[model samples]
Target: MTVRKVLIFGRFERFWHWSQMVLIIVLMFSGFGLHGFHALLDFELAVALHTYAALALLVLWLFSVFWLFTTETWRHFLPTGRGLWQVLRFYTYGIFRGERHPYRKAFWRKHNPLQALAYLMLKVVLFPLIWITGLLYLFYFLWRDLPHASDLLFAVAVVHTGAAFAILAFVFIHVYMLTTGHSFAEHVAPMMTGFDEVELTPEEEAYLEKDQPAMIR
Candidate 1:
């Protein structure tokens, strides 16, 4: 079988991807350790490790955002109402038939409508909620000394814990989704090699030709 390889991820993009993965894994483990999930890492050490990893991940996220926006790569995340249903239906009912994905990754667009929406929510709501809430919890003791601040400790902890678990859920789903591609490493290979092997479904290809003139051959 012949496969056409298209460059999907840039060098810096892969760097950001892998680095963020390592940091997030470290943070998750350390954060859970701090919560006494197990006696692996002591509370103090876990807190320190979590904080450092969080900071690094936050910096990496910021840099990625800046790069995407400045380079106009942000278009990849534009949520499209038209293809949303098609993408969802395909994922829900089509893949089991060895079906091609309803949405195809193009040169100008890296994500499909569904991926765009999911990623947008992760960036705007999920990650920010986790970062902000976690930050507040991290500084809870220091801020508690301020008048009326003590009342927020419980609230902040709840938000932080909730966001953490939400992110963990996303991580689990994300990993599973990666396996849905042509091969177990089909999707992940692009993240490392910066190239993706794209195969389009007939229905989606026909739709693209009729709707997206620029994308039609």
Candidate 2:
């Protein structure tokens, strides 16, 4: 077995990735505690911490947007509905039978069709909905005297809470999938080192024997 060190993640990218992970986890714990999940942190303190963490995440996201545009990393996430069916087929049937991945990673593109779609929805739709509604709910008290503000606040709160749960569910699924790489920490190593190891299985080896290079360029 040979270990190769590849450049996977850059310094700022890794910093943002790990820092956001920590902040999100902290926010989740405090947010849930505020919802009466054993009261580890008092309601007031939880609210304060939640707000702080949310703001930090928002700033991190802004930095990420700038980074993506500057580095052209946004190209990696370009949604491709054309291969949606094939991606589903691979996940549902091909992988189970030890088939090769239909999608290949390149310098300009990192995600498969399914991954792009899911990530796009999560960022463009789900995250914005959560952020907007949460902000409105957070400042509801400041507008309590306005007409119909009460009803609007309640509605926004419901949406915010619902999105929060959905985000949590996505996190669980995302973490599990992260481990489905060349090895247990394969996907994880990329985030830490900025380079992912692309391996060829026995099936792929047959094709490589015909002179097709297996390593990703």
Query: How does each model score on lDDT?
Result: 0.79, 0.76
- Go through the candidates in order and give the clash count of each: 0, 5
**Which stretches of candidate 1 lie above 4 Å from their native place?**
1-4, 198-217
lDDT tens digits, residues 1-217, model 2? 2223334466888898899889879878988887676688978899899999988899999999899899887876788777788879988898888887677654345677888888888889888997888778777788889999889887887887788788899899888776553565766877876766434454544444455443323
After best superposition, candidate 2 residue 5: deviation in angstroms? Answer: 6.9
- For candidate 1, the lDDT comes to 0.79
**Cα lDDT tens digits for candidate 1, 1-217:** 2223555677888898899889989988998887778779978898889999998888898899999999888888887897889888888888777788877666667788888898899889988988998878777777878877866877777777788899899899889988885667766888988877545556655655578544333
Candidate 1 clashing pairs? none
Clashing pairs in 2: 7-194, 7-195, 8-194, 8-195, 9-194
Per-model TM-score, in order, reads 0.85, 0.82
Which numbered prediction scores highest in TM-score against the true structure?
1
User: How many angstroms is residue 7 displaced in model 1 relative to the true structure, after the best TM-score fit?
Assistant: 1.7
